[model samples]
Target: MPGSLSAYLSQVEEDGADYVVIDTPPHAGGTIDAAIRAADLVVIPIRPGPFDINAAAGTVGIMKQTGRPGIFVLSQVAAVGPEGDDTAAVLQELYPDVPVAKARLGQRKAFMQALISGQAITEFDRPSSKAVGEIKALFREVRSRL
Candidate 1:
């Protein structure tokens, strides 16, 4: 873990990166533990589902235990539906101390296509894609806290 953390931080520092985003696995592991310890802020992306919500709780617990600040970003949300709101509310209620991002990412084909095409959503096709906007907004929300 030290080797991994050193390599990861060295690159970010050497490259003069403003932010380093680490995507942890669904379940708890050594990598996640190291990340939470090394992170300035943790971003937990949760889907509006029973399993996801349950998993997020465990992640949030790790954050709290480590005395690390974290935020929840509701991912793959419906564009116009009650599920997003209801899920956010439930999450907030469950973890009152953790902050949830107002900028939610809706389920979009552009996101999947961007991965398949090996390109960013902003670079995939249309510059005016809502997926791009959503990501930018999420970045802003995360950056503002830092």
Candidate 2:
């Protein structure tokens, strides 16, 4: 289980998987480090706040050191406010080269409800809802870039 990230990635490649999404913890750890180093492109999901932004800076540094491209995805952002824009501005100023995702996943009850139901947002009721649309758009962006 430990130290098998590379092996798992190899297996995915060998199996011809279309996409490999590895979710890493916010803090730096061995597994996250290994995943960032091995990732073709790293997606760092950050909340709209100073602390989260700062934390992501450290991770971005590691991605840069590994010579891997990394993008920022603003998660659980409030829809009706300038806070998300401000946060995106801060990230853009900090990492001018890194692309800040245009698609922001707004904080909604649907996501939590889906989690409680042990299903993905798409699998939840009202698959054509706005919540599902945002996720689908985000996925398409990530997929196209990859």
Candidate 3:
């Protein structure tokens, strides 16, 4: 039962959301199988590290099995120094089918600040320029997917 799986696809259809951002557990469990089965497009978040890139091999294959288009988002990118570029370069070679060409969501303290205050980044700090820019660009990018 490698690719055979069960998910809330029927409920998702009924939920009527314009998009779904599924956060799967970090393993090939029933949950991941379910999400893959339900997803129309899989966006794999990659951290710049050896193990992280290796993990993506399984991720790419799993997403492909669902017959869905996929993309990779480089997350936790401190800076594109040797380590970051090296990781990205290797990932490109590994999962050529998945687009690893999106803007990196920089690791920002604002995210933690907003989370601690129990607010979305948009509402967390109206005057914080960083939060405003990140939220705006994030929405714009997501909207482009449609």
Structure candidate 3, residue pairs in collision: none
lDDT of 1: 0.86
**Candidate with more favorable, higher TM-score: 1 or 3:** 1
lDDT of 1 by residue, 28-62 (tens): 48778888888889998988877788888777888
Per-residue lDDT over 38-98 for candidate 3, one digit per residue giving the tens place of the 0 to 100 score: 7776777777888778787777777778777777777667744666677678888877777
- Give the range where candidate 3 is weakest over 10 consecutive residues by summed lDDT: 1-10
C-alpha RMSD by candidate, in order: 1.3, 1.4, 3.6
Local distance difference test, per candidate?
0.86, 0.86, 0.70
Q: Residue 85 of candidate 2: its Cα lDDT?
A: 92
Clashing pairs in 1: none
Number of clashes in every candidate structure?
A: 0, 0, 0
C-alpha positional error of residue 6 in candidate 1 after TM-score superposition, expressed in Å: 2.4
lDDT of 2 by residue, 1-146 (tens): 33688888889899999888988787747777788887878998888999899998778888878888988999899979888999999999999989998888989999899999999899995878989998998998888778
